[model samples]
Target: MSETKISKLFTELNQLKWSVVSKGVIVGLFAGFVVALYRLGIEFATEKSIEIYEFLKHNQEYIIVWIVVIVVVGLLIAWLIKCSPESKGSGIPQVEGVVLMGMKMRSFFIIPVRFIAGILSAFFGVSLGREGPSIQIGACGGDIIASKLSHNKLEENYLITAGASAGLAAAFNAPLSGIIFALEEIHRSFSPNILLAATTAALTADVVSKTIFGLKPVLSYVDIPALPLSQYGWLLLLGILTGVVGALVNKFVLVSSKVYDVLPAWSRPMVALLLALPFGLFLPQVLGGGQNLVQLSETAQMTVGVLFVVFIAKLFFTTSSFGSGIPGGIFMPILSMGAIVGSIFAQTLSGFGIPASSIAILCICSMAGVMAGSVKAPITSILLMAEMTGSLVHLLPVAAVAFIALLTSDLLGIHPIYEVLLERLVDKDHVNKKHDNIVLEIVVEMGSDVAGKKVSEVNWPTGTLIAGIRRGQKEYVPNGDFIIYHGDYLIVLSSEHELETMNTCLNKLCRKN
Candidate 1:
């Protein structure tokens, strides 16, 4: 073809935008329905758990029967996890393993096991949320579909990311948050290729979810007045408090996991289920994912003292409930804790003439603040709270709180919770597979060792090759003299044997040492 015709052809592929949108829609269709169903399953199971607890509270004679049932369910969950070890704890790290680390996940096994395991865990009143499992399921769904449809592994990874965004979108009915979380937390970069697919998938999933659940905000905080400018100082204080407490919660979860390390993996869930029995009967308010507690605080049903006690109980329960390698998420539990803390803070300062109108606003922002601190995805957290509240009215204050909280967590030397979990997973189950040639996309982060370096200056792995560099809407085949900027997406080629080592080396170079 002539140069003009070739240029036209390249222009048609502008940013490769259309290439991924259809794939994203397909992944979204699969993930949206699946995760929405997963959400429904958890909701139904949790309601049944509440009913069972109410019965146990009244009829002491049947407590033993309920206990037996718990043991059986626990064993079932354990067996389900054994069927696929990838179904364990939150599943976000597993997705990261597949997408970022060039690892593998079996969607056929993971989807079904995670669905059943998540439902069972919720059924018995485990304090875990459905969000993490949902994301994993969605990601697997994307991977399975992409494997059949895409021509390359990189495309499959992009679709996998799209599925993850869809999963979170459907779970919380927050599409923008879903997209942002996939980019910020899961992939840790915002390449245009990723942005294109992730946005499509998240929006599509949100549409399907809304079709099922209706047009209401996940949590009803309508007409809640924003905090006044004079109250901005309180937001800074709230950020510090939640930042410190969220980091502590993250540490507590790791410690709890360590404590459970003494037990065989299968037996760990049994202990967590047994712990649930007491809470099921006595403190049902803090039971399950603690969604009711969030609702209560939103409606002002709980007092400062009551919120404090319940917060303590839920905090301890969540660590054990999640730490035992159960199939659930920290998203809701952490948000609830933040809501409770915000409520307590607002109430404590109520005597000082802070208006009650600001109570719900603070509660909402604090949810974002806590998640931002713990997850290390400040932008995603802010957008998540905004989407969940179904308004942008609180974005300014919420952004303030989330940023401060993230800053606080960083100063304390606490890494993101998912990053830590991914490291532990690597140490425990590092599986190396055999592939003839595999392509992975690694994004150059800002402040990385290689950010300002030229291609010739950086030391690459022996077998690794930089296939191409993607910068925004443009793509270029680099010569050694080309300068690689931060935010560039690199297409790399390697085999299975060297995948792990190359990944480690590249990450070291692409991240701040």
Candidate 2:
């Protein structure tokens, strides 16, 4: 993993730009169709679940029969997890462990297990979202496709990322947000080639989904006036409130998973299914990833008290569903919760002289805030809000709210939900496992500690070596007296198992303060 070796590796990739990009397009196409069908299936299941609940409400004699059916379905889900353990819970963490931590991904096993179990979970009124399952299906299937078409592992990884981008785009019909999420949340790199592939895949996949579903925002609210500048104070308060709530959600989600660990693996899903039974009888609105609840918020006349109750029920249901190791995500549930919080806040401030039309806009703003606080991806949150709404008029307020919420969560020492989950996944094997050598290219920023220092003067991380430095058109192998200048790309090599340590060390030295 020397500079010359790294250069040679990338040079080979540069020469096959068309090959790589075309592979990306192929993955995108595959991801688009598959994830679209996945979305279609979930939508159908959700509708059927509601109808059945409605029917059961009238047919009291058949309630016991329905309960028996639910138990059987729960057992079936447990067997599905037994068939594919990696398919359990949110698949994002498993995918991350594959690309980042060298964990194995059963490309073939995930698609079927997740698809079937996800549909079953939704049809049974689990408060879990489809976005995570869609991404997993896309990534695993993308990896399968890329493995056959690509000549190298690097190319395969790039195509997988592209496929993941496609999946998110198809799920939400937000192409730009998908690309940004790929870069900001998944890859965590800004290489031009990665950007080129992700953009092409995301846009094309979005086209396919739009063709099937039409070009409408994934979620919609009644037309509302944009917030006036004088109402900035309210945005400030909303940001802090959503931030606190989001951090607490991260904590609860983790705790919920741990609580389920006490049960044997085969019986976990059964517990959650039984828990959801009561809600299906009385609070069906708070089920199935909160889609029903959000629709209720938009069209129903609701009080703050009602919203509070709904929020609590939705939170509990989501945690239980996910904790039982259901193959789903918190993406929609979090947004739904944020919307509830927003509506409650707006109603409480009815006497603040806020315009009647502007009341509905707060829900969207609070969504961005809570997403930033929970996911810790502020740029992704901002773009997702914009693309999902198809309106740029609210960008300023959303950005303000998102950044403030992000800051509040940072101050509270709350980690991002995905990162926390990833740690729990990797920590068990990380203790003694050895990994292959990996090279990382990081930029030197103006405010970085090493910006103006000599290479020998800075203390690098343990088990790491500076492989090379690229400044402008010139490349230099680092020597003790070599100066580290701003905007230089430093190529550092470290063992894969040591990446977390190296990244922590490098960020303090190379990233802007």
Candidate 3:
């Protein structure tokens, strides 16, 4: 109660916080190993898949073989989901559930399965992004560490945040952006503890990934130049246009998902197959990561019509793949689509006699603008774009467009895709539930004897009983007889003193379970 006493208490608390962060650094280093290997596997699969595609392109005899390969990849994805439902979509929403809603789901099997399956799907020409799955997988590593290394709830959460940041950093070789992403998007909070854990994780992940793959930016040699002062007007115009397109894309994706659901479950794959064939035949540039299109735009070689067609095709495929509930991500597709559209906008100016250098600058800004509009993370998008392209020269134009595009998108009622996806992942009825005052969140770990036990068998401490369980999409109001499963989120409610005793009892029960 005295000033000296308060100061001593504060010092002890600070020491405790740093100790947790030190443990986080160890967890992050461990998680980085998984992330580095995961990225390596993706690159290897991508290389082999391209080789097969080249072989099929030249050999008429191999055309049927290509069809078989494509069909097999589709069936494999369908089968993986059919068997283990957790491997669906970008793993972002699931990770968010684990952190925010007390949903328990482990990555022990799911992460590796996703790495193999996602790489296969992408390599075999299934339209997807590698980063989203990789990030989710990386976060799983953190979740694993959190559960294994500590029974402290705060410590576990910090580790989870760290692991997720490491995964993103490893995937893109952008350590700073990954840390920002964990703070801005994943944790949705900023504190000294969270910052320390996330920084350690991201920095560690990048170091590991770079050691394995070399310290190169994901997209190479993008000569982003500064636009003339007069060109600022066009950049603003580009941002407004991107806002409209982003809104439209969101609409189409939501509609497509609804339509896909209306179809019979078995019939969904056939629809995706049909969509892929036509797009594959006519616009191969829009296929895969669309890295080629990005390269073309940087070189200022794509014509306006070509860029427009690529944009349309990319949008359609992205809608089809994501809407049909394919196990993939939109990060790359959305960014690539925006880049193509931006290229066309810049090309239009070139036709109007805008200088070539100015057009290039505008093109880069347009990419950042649309990505900011679509994701609704303007600062993150700008930093990611600048990092990805390895250029800070266009920061002013990028900022101008990103601000306008983000503002316009908000006016049109657009939400970030991950936020929207999380909402959709939760059942509508659950959203309407009012949990205004009652809840307790706890993280479970491997060594906790509770790791493999049922709720009914474990004796809870006095004044505490499990009220509900949330594992991934599933939630339950537990009866006294229910069992607690691993990665199962136990929602317990109690008073301050009861909670304290309950926490100690839970820890002891965890030791014995």
Instruction: Write down the worst ten-residue block by lDDT for model 3.
Output: 429-438
- Which residue pairs clash in candidate 3? 104-487, 147-445, 449-513, 454-484, 455-483, 455-484
- Give each model a TM-score: 0.94, 0.91, 0.79
Candidate that would win on TM-score: 1
RMSD of each: 2.9, 2.8, 11.3
User: Which one wins by lDDT: 1 or 2?
Assistant: 1
- Cα lDDT of model 2 by residue, 432-513, tens digit: 2225455566678787899999999998888878877878756677789999998887867667778767866886788776
Best by lDDT: 1
* lDDT (Cα, tens digit) per residue for candidate 3, span 408-476: 899999988777877777653222111222235454545676666666666667777565565655556
lDDT of 1 by residue, 305-357 (tens): 88888999999999999999889999899999999988898888988867888
lDDT of 2 at 248: 79
**lDDT score for residue 255 of model 2:** 94
- List clashing residue pairs in candidate 1: none
